[model samples]
Target: MANSPQSKKRARQAVRRNDVNKARRSRIRTYLRKVEEAIASGDKAVAQDALKNAQPELMRGVTKGVVHKNTAARKISRLAARVKALG
Candidate 1:
């Protein structure tokens, strides 16, 4: 439905951005799942390490606009608390 040339270009850009954002979101979820599995397995050391690795990935998601800043903060906070409680 993009009749204008500009609109066509915009549509193309949107598709590319959507694909990139989807990949980034999937990657972030994989990292979070790693942390969750580690936590569920009751291994504090592995959970701590997974959380450590996930922090940068989550922050990257925020910086790339795939995730909200406050949402990232809340997620990291809760995950850290859960990891800590595994003590």
Candidate 2:
């Protein structure tokens, strides 16, 4: 379908970018899940630590264009609130 050389090159680039983005998204989800599990387990200290580790990953996702800035902010805010409530 990509008849032009430029289009073919773009398609190839897109495939590579897609793989990279997918991996990034998966990594972000894994980090978020760690925080969630920590919270669910009701271990405030572990949750706090997980949150600390996840905050930067989430922000990195935003900076890398995997997630929106406000989205990451909201997630961090809500998770922080939940972690605080555990106290």
Candidate 3:
């Protein structure tokens, strides 16, 4: 419980930030899922396109502080490798 006015304000802000972050996370997951599905379908072209679209969104998540930079990098790296191996 926030006893002080400032703490209450912070609590409110945190709730708002949490909602935004949740949405961002969901969006990122959707993008990742698209790439996964494309890869799973064994279509290199579609997978490459999906990866192309997902990369910026992932990086955007990193920049917005919703995702860690290294985590995003690792994901991109792994996905790229999978797409490369799809040939």
Candidate 4:
């Protein structure tokens, strides 16, 4: 119910942004899942590499406003700990 032209434009922009954000979120989740699977497989080396790859993606999510800074930090911290414990 965007009656005003500005509102309609905003709605359109929001829809576009939503799609982009959704794609970014999905990609981030995929990276996180890779780390989880690597960890689950009990290969410390693979898990370490996966975590290394995922760290930047998670941080990118935070920078892109798809995730909070502390949330990204916590996830990276926990994943790093788990990977380390695989030793």
Candidate 5:
């Protein structure tokens, strides 16, 4: 029900943004899942590497507005702790 031209344009923009954000979120999740799988496999080295890779992706998500800053920080902190404990 976007009667106004501006509203219609906004709706279109929203759809585009939704697609981009969805892809970004999915990519971030893939990175996190890699770390989790490595951790589950009990491979400390691989887990550490995956964690290192995922940390930046998560932070990038925060910067891109795809994720909340505190949420990203908490996730990274907890994952780091888990990686450290794998020793």
Candidate 6:
């Protein structure tokens, strides 16, 4: 639906950015899922390790604009609390 040449170029660029961002989002979700599964296993050590690994990945996603800072922080906080309560 982009008529002008510039608009078409912008649209194309947006498509590429969307694909990259989608991949980043998926990667972040996978990291989060790992932490969740580790927690569900009731192994504090494994859950802690998974949370350690996921923290940086989630922060990276924030910096890349794929995830919001507060959202990531809230998720980390909640997951940490759950992991702590596992004992």
C-alpha RMSD of each candidate structure in angstroms = 0.5, 0.6, 0.6, 0.5, 0.5, 0.7
Best-performing candidate as measured by lDDT: 3
**lDDT of candidate 1 over 20-87, digit per residue (tens):** 99999999999999999999999999999999999999999999999999999999999999999999
Candidate 2 per-residue lDDT, tens place, 1-87, comes to: 899999999999999999998998899899899999999999999999999999999999898898999999999999999999998
TM-score of each: 0.98, 0.97, 0.97, 0.98, 0.98, 0.96
lDDT for model 2, on a 0 to 1 scale?
Answer: 0.95
RMSD of 3: 0.6
- How good is model 5 by TM-score? 0.98
Can you give the lDDT of residue 19 in candidate 3? 99
Model 4 earns a TM-score of 0.98
Tens digit per residue, CA lDDT, model 6, 1-87: 999999999999999999999999999999999999999899999999999999999999999999999999999999999999999
Put down candidate 5 lDDT per residue, 12-87, tens digits, no spaces: 9999999999999999999999999998999999999999999999999999999999999999999999999999
Question: How well does candidate 2 score on lDDT at residue 17?
Answer: 91
Point out where model 2 deviates above 4 Å: none
Error of 6 at 17 (Å): 0.5
> What is each predicted model's overall lDDT from 0 to 1?
0.98, 0.95, 0.99, 0.97, 0.96, 0.97
TM-score, structure 6 vs. true: 0.96
Candidate 4 ranges beyond 4 A from true positions: none
Clash total of candidate 2: 0
Candidate 6 Cα misplacement greater than 4 A, ranges: none
